[model samples]
Target: MPTTTGMKGGGYYDANSREQRSASQIFLPWLEAAIADLPEPPPHQQSWNLLDIGSSEGANAIYTTERLITALRENSDLPIWALFDDLPTNDFNQMFLNLFPTGKSVIPANDVYTAAIGGSAFGRLVPPASLHVATTFNAIGFFETRPIAVLPGFILPMRPNPQAPREGVQVSEDELIPFQKQAHQDLCHFYRARAAELAPGGKLLVQIFGRNETHSTGHGICDVLSDALLDFVEADMLPRFFYENFIFPASYRNTAELIAPIESERELASAFRIEQVEARDVPVPFNDAFTANEDRAAWAKSYTGFLRAFTEPVLAAALPDGLPQENTIEKIYHRIDRLLQDYPDRYEFHFISIATLLTRL
Candidate 1:
């Protein structure tokens, strides 16, 4: 598999999973915060017209829409209209079916439509200055690799070296920095395009896993994997295999790192202003049964499954050769299982969710 420098694949959440649901739980409170900040609807407009960009499976969209409906109904205002949009590949129809089955009122008046779009296709689907609010939950950070879409640069130093196999193709630290920078730049393009699509008064709310400045010490299991891979590359031992088998398939940024490109892009333009930026720690409580049973097998399975599904494929594709299709996945699974047994504490993952409300200037 040849690695692509740009956004190459959809993440795991694209398919519904329990971990995805768990991760999304963090956004419930954030959604409430965003709705509370919304300006009062105009006197004549019957309801708010909302656009949910990158609405994967429409979970967040449905949840937010329902909440807005409750708020509006309490005020005796008309119902709200919501448009759920995503890549054409997303199952918007199914999402609608699931959320609106038999008129549950997840969407008041149920005026929902699906707008399928590409990275460059947003302008065509949304009318200029038409939406009251636009939200993108855990999406919109991905950007295409083309030069026109390149984001600004940033340095992500590799973790300290680990033991190496000691032969074959070597990796250079200098090269990885550029790769990391390009990744950041690409993400900026996606966010800027999203910002451009919003109406003047319309707000764009984005939620994504971000790097925590306080916690990013390259010590977590994810960090250890990165370190081990970089060491393999530097040692020139199975570098190609490492890239093909691991990095490309499972790479991701911490909250701070993910936010850098967006903030950089904002600084370069005055067209959109960020209204709020915040981060909070989310801890998942695991009972004694969760830890004691199956040698943490269930926990490991759930954690790695989510990581592999959402984070791996893209990174795998981005590598020089990408993940091998043969028995490689099975091997990788076993390798992760072993690692989990060795490092149970590292498996206690801490995620940073960043919420930004951007208004068109």
Candidate 2:
């Protein structure tokens, strides 16, 4: 499988295909519920306009449009305009074009100029006070941190501290605190900027990843490995290797931590009101056929492609100069493979996520 070396945001989304699938399932139901709560469409202005932020491959956009159309078919005059926006690096335009070759039911608009979290207004794609609704799935959380490790190759001059022992590189309390503060600031900026574009009475639905206190068997192994890797860095066992190879460079914030930034954003305070906030534990089950036949090996290999893409480079850059890249890769693969092999019957992966429905006041 191809790695995330050239992608933006350190290829965080590139890992774990299951994560995307899980997000899709979770968001679809929430969206349906939100739409149902809205006032009935006006007879003269039966049209609805939707903007999807961080629409990676446009699959979610397409799926959402399809569901809305099905639900509102009684109003034949109701027209839907769907806009899929993402970073310029994302192939959203191509994905939309391919999916809607005829361009009959779907209108594809690209809003790539704005940053994921915040930036200039999207005046070109969305006129002032024109959008009826906006939705983001698993995207808003990214603004919490600006993966510093993924900076351009030219900016690679700042190497990891070398004074630490071979076992791990020591990161001072000073360094860690600043990093956390910056991440919080970035997240607040993102929410405030997003709140500005929303039209009064419009709805914004967001679902994002969050940190939880509990850990599960499916995720425990990977979490332990992540902790071990961090330990190695603190000991200076391999400073450069640790910095380069860590995939999930940013940490997940718990529900309270995630809510604080949005609630405190100055721009969002006056215009947007939180309508509904819901939290749930969703466990994704692997396909029954794959597990029934005991083809756990294939499932693990397929799933690990995303995991490796996310973690390999980060791990490689953080290890000591002497650690072989190929060996580390093999070790990660073998560890995951063994886990799957040992527990072939069922592997339940749980995600604790928040769904917030914000209405423009």
Candidate 3:
């Protein structure tokens, strides 16, 4: 297995992450509700600390936090420290560029100090009970570590795409059960860490790509990527071993899986009260535009760019070091683009996310 590097860096992720940004709009109302009942800061604290974990490249996360901080400012005139956290390998420079463009703060008024912290999202990064409000949007679906060695048949463990058929590449429940368990364990770790960091009566909002009864975020996208790689293997351009060893280390959990730890674990149950838990589908901007204009070429490029922005870094890492890595990766993406253009409706993407708002007890 390849080492876990973060998303594509140096402004690439920020440029192509429209789907993620659009999906996060659902959190605005939930965030307002959380802020409406936010508790006062501790006596010793000088500044209100708001933490954003899994903050990728910064366009989406910054937009969300700006609104959150602005809303918080309306209630009180306390100094706010907005902190962004992500993996060490993430594009922090690019994120800082986005946050502090023109060398000005994200929120110019009201003592708002913006900073970045580099680390894993699964562990505690701040002092105990220091955070007043915390959020993670369109992140946390990724496991901190790869749970299983090799996903034998499919690129992702989610239910196979009914639209893109793979005759021999079906994942059974037996294979899927362990993956689900790992996802549950990861969610537990995340909540445990957040529970420790949040102050008494603090609000924590976690929203990530997830599955519902009707749709999953990974269904069509992963299937298409899997098919594109298989085409290269059949043409003798790539080795068979590459396909077997490559597995995306992320899982989309259902609402039951999202809330199971809070209900089952004694520690979590004692520490927090669930304010809301729900899963819903959000509109895909590129897909909607495609529907409106009926422009196949434009749709293919936009959709493929979004897919490559998130998946390409990991895909590049999975390749053998000796082979022309850049060219091979480009070929794969190009193949995907051609495939999407040829059969525009074959692989359609639907965005569904599970969200939970919790209050520390």
Candidate 4:
């Protein structure tokens, strides 16, 4: 199957992924350090450029861009240009509104310039050798291909049980080998493009859903979502064709694999130095206020809502063409909620976050 970074409509991301604020903050220190370490450009050069990859619905954009502008101003008098990049179907209007929600710019208008760039990170999005800094957070998980058309019993490529495929999940190395190569290729493509787009001494900061080990990287969150989606099949809410062609549109890179491209690809190794690469395990909100009030139904509903906002578009797109009742989207989520309520303790997640800092050589 061809690849796609699943399209998201207005507000789907911000409303669901509450962790974006915290995740986006990870960019600040890296951005500031990169700016501080930047080589003195030609005396005549008085402007700098920054690119934000996969800026969904602008939640993280607001925090990161604000800090970015502030950081840029402290180091240089040069005006900074910020470019926000994502899929064409992403919410650009909401991003601008987020940056200037009160009809007033968050930073001095004369100090920094900002614009939205709509495109995939798999290929080039900016002018060659012109950028001074680039950042990507929680977005690289969305790969540009569907390596596995459908995992019969589950969706997560991050296996909790690595040695054996989960029940109902049909796959083989014959299928996974090529898919793994493709994911690595996609990552290499992203970095090579950055290497070309970044000026000498520039830096690229990346944070994506990934792991530090080759073992099963699966988390409770993945299980919850898979159970929810599979619950629909059990309830007969969705037909079999939906599952036959369905698969999650993400690729979670492993720890060593995160920077393998930079090491193996001569061009990448020549162009950038891996300043630091570390993985952190973050917790997911499970039986919080949503589950403590003794309202299991309410908790399930709320949890399902959270997942639905970010995933509904992709789920709906998987429906068989011309099928009716496909628009009963809430029913699917209801099924998910029902499943979650039945297994609240199992509805957790441990995010293995890979943070990497790269300096252009």
Candidate 2 lDDT tens digits, 1-361 = 1112212233233334455456545756655665655555456654666677666555445566556545444334456666666655555444555465586435333321111221211223355555567776655544343444332111111222221122332334444454466556655655555565555677777666554556322243243344344444455543544444444443344556555665776566677777766655654444443556657776666445545544555455444556534475466556656655555433334456666777777
Please, what's the RMSD in Å of model 3? 1.6
Q: Estimated TM-score per prediction?
A: 0.66, 0.65, 0.97, 0.87
Total clashing pairs in model 2:
29
- Full-model lDDT, candidate 4: 0.70
> Which tens-of-lDDT digit does each residue in 235-312 have in candidate 4?
776666566566666677775788999999999989989988877764444335554577777766656666676567
lDDT of 3 by residue, 270-329 (tens): 989999988879888889999899998999898898989889988988887765345989
Q: Rank the candidates by TM-score, best first.
A: 3, 4, 1, 2
Give candidate 1 misplaced runs (Cα > 4 Å). 1-47, 72-76, 91-97, 100-125, 146-184, 216-269, 285-295, 315-327, 346-348
Candidate 3: clashing pairs of residues: none
lDDT digits (tens) for residues 163-245 of candidate 1: 31224323456546655665576556555665555555566666655445554222243543443444445555334443434
Question: Each candidate: RMSD to true structure?
Answer: 6.3, 8.1, 1.6, 3.2
| lDDT to native, each model | 0.50, 0.50, 0.85, 0.70
Sorting all predicted structures by lDDT, with the top scorer first, yields 3, 4, 2, 1
Q: Which stretches of candidate 2 lie over 4 Å from their true place?
A: 1-18, 36-47, 72-76, 101-127, 143-176, 216-240, 243-247, 287-295, 306-349
What is residue 176's positional error in candidate 4, in angstroms?
A: 2.3
